[model samples]
Target: MNLTQKAMLGVSAVAMATALAGCGQTTTYPRTAPPTDSQCRDWEWDSKNGVYRCDDSSSSYYRNYYYGNSYYSSRSALQKSSSYSAYKSSITSKTSSGFGKGSSIGGG
Candidate 1:
């Protein structure tokens, strides 16, 4: 084969190799089962006061929920008491019951 053709083939092979390497790549979150300790984190989340919980995407993906809202984790302070559970229940009850058939904005 000519040098020019050989160089082109080399470039094409390198490109194909890189492309194939990326095909099997998968993103994985390392959270598994509920944390045993009062304070632990496995995935990205949001926290306020002493309350910690998974964000929107993580909530649906991991099924980490308390009441109706997604709660992946909580700080030691919240875990030390029952108040957090009560708070979660209140928030979930209110939000979940807010839905109605006409809630959807669009109509056919």
Candidate 2:
């Protein structure tokens, strides 16, 4: 290829790399489990205080903050949590639950 074509190819490659780099970043958040303690051996979340229980060590310094890897310790905990129950009730309580229902406009 000629000089101009080579330059264009290089520019395209850089642009594609930059876009991919931006898209590759994953969300992160503080560990759901509590910090380590003198007697703790495993992460034991203390949902009530928004902290991990002092008796357990955290799994990691940070966790992937995404839908599939939720901070919850287990499925049972997630299902039993008030937020889960509330969300579940909201969807099942209504005949037209979940997206597709046009939003309502209000003037009050």
Candidate 3:
């Protein structure tokens, strides 16, 4: 082909390459911890007379406090807390990654 035609093709190829390269970028998010108190505390305690009982109007206490039941309760609470924490952490990380103006893939 002619030199002028070859140069135009080279320029067009470079532009296309650059445009396609943009589609393969790595998406990232900032590391963040989840919400501790607010998320975990919202779980409703089992109020049935069989396993758990409310000691008083205060929501924390439960009755029929046996060893196995206590263990189960603690484990359940921890699992719920951790799940909520993880969810919150992910959301925070995504938000930070999206809005972090200074953060970029390559160091400028």
Q: Regarding lDDT, does 2 or 3 come out ahead?
A: 2
Task: Look at candidate 1 and tell me the lDDT of residue 93.
Answer: 48
Per-prediction TM-score: 0.27, 0.27, 0.26
Question: lDDT by residue for model 1 over 26-96, one digit each (tens)?
Answer: 32222334333332234333233323344345334342433223343335544444665676555544533
Q: Write the per-residue lDDT of candidate 2 for residues 42-103, one digit (tens) a residue.
A: 54453332334333335342321112234454456656667656654554345232222221
Off by over 4 Å in 2: 28-34, 42-72, 75-108
Each model's lDDT comes to: 0.41, 0.42, 0.39
Q: Over all chains combined, what TM-score does candidate 3 have? A: 0.26
Better of 1 and 3 by TM-score: 1
CA error at residue 81 for candidate 3, angstroms:
15
Name the weakest run of 10 consecutive residues (lDDT summed) in model 3.
63-72
Q: Pick the candidate with the highest lDDT.
A: 2
After TM-score superposition, the amount by which residue 9's alpha carbon in candidate 3 deviates from its true location, in angstroms, is 0.3
Per-residue error at 86 for model 1, in Å? 27
